[model samples]
Target: MNVTLLMAITINGFVAGQDDDTEWVKDIDALYKMTAEAGVAIMGKRTYDECVKYNAFPYKGALNIVMTHDKTLLTKSTDDVIFTDATPQGALQLLEQKGFDHALVIGGGNINGSFLKAGLINEIILDIHPMVMAKGIHLFEGDFPYQQLELMSFTKINDDLLQVKYRVKNNYENS
Candidate 1:
């Protein structure tokens, strides 16, 4: 299974503000396109909560799973949405068992860090915007070991945005 980390972050590497505000992000269509292509997206509870707060819940055309311990927040989950308390590796294993060819970690710091720490992310696709927020949640929250990546491709998404794709180098394989 291919595990890709797909995210849009500020120039300073912040995904969102302290209040879970994403007013700075401008490309909803791009995100929807990625969601459509990935078919499966895993996000932290904060990401889900922010989407719901902004009336963007139930991302269509994909199975969205919210990785959270407090599953009680959701009274129930439908086919399009589900809650799980699985670790990063466990979540990927479950998805693979279900026959998903690709899984995208659409994040809010903690989830991204967990996957990177667990060495579950194979690639990273970042759409870097022009703005920067000094005080906000970072791209990855915890301290993870240094990761090596080889750039696969890069393109200008628009006049103000650039998208970069990289293949995460497996140290064990390379060594």
Candidate 2:
């Protein structure tokens, strides 16, 4: 399956403010369009909560999977939205079983790191915003294994936004 880790972060690499404020990450129609085209999307609980708090829950036109240990979310599961405690791989497996060949790993931070650290991510497309925060949530929450990425493309989404795409190198490809 093809998995893409797609996110928007500050130039300094913060995805949200220290207090989890993501007001700066708003209204990027490009991001919404990309994830929607993927047919399926998975995100961590915190990310899901933020999306909800911002009135952006249940990404339209895609199967939205929320990964968390909070089983109560199961009650909210439906044909289009699934709340589960599945691992990143497990979530993607579910997507594959549903006949999806590709998915987008939407994120806040920790989820992005988990998928990358597990070597499950195939591509990363970052929407680089204009500001920098001294203290905040990073692009990747935990320590990463330092796999390299091949530069695929980089261009302006607008005057203040720049989008960069990279293909994650597999273990053998790095050799």
Candidate 3:
């Protein structure tokens, strides 16, 4: 299956910060709309829970896969949503089994870190917000091996947000 990482980071280079208001809701909502239109959505436990809380709606009719340690918490349903406690590797395995052509990796830090460390991500779609916070979680927790990216496209969405799409360079043998 083809893997893609979709995330939004603040211009200051933080994901989550001291204040909960980092325009993340708007960014995430935009991502959710895009992914939902694409027919599948995958996210970390924290992000999934946050979406559930904020949206006040279950991801019904859409494939909602949650990455977490507690697999038992996931409901059993194939028609709508399915949860798996798999890390990036496990999730990719499951997606492969299900014959998924593409998957979106949504996260704050840990999720992105796992994919980058494992060299599994194929593309990155980042929504850059134009505000800086003093402290917050970054997209990369620490300095991992550098991976080159080729800018595919970019669009200016309003004055405060920039949507950039990049393909991970030579990260995948067949890609």
Runs with alpha carbons beyond 4 Å of true place in candidate 3: 19-29, 71-78, 170-175
TM-scores for all candidates: the values are 0.93, 0.93, 0.82
lDDT by residue (37-117, candidate 2, tens digit) is: 998888999999888888988899888988888868877799889998878888888888888999999986899988987
lDDT for each candidate structure: 0.87, 0.86, 0.71
lDDT of 1: 0.87
Query: Where does model 2 exceed 4 Å of error?
Result: 171-175
Model 1, position 131, has a per-residue lDDT of 89
Question: Per-residue lDDT tens digits of candidate 3, residues 1-175?
Answer: 6777777888776777764444453555577676766556677677666677677334543467777776465655455566776667887787678777787777757778878878888888888887777877787665457788899999998777898999888543432
Report the lDDT of model 1 for residue 84. Answer: 84
Tens digit of per-residue lDDT, candidate 1, span 1-31? 8999999999899999868778878788889
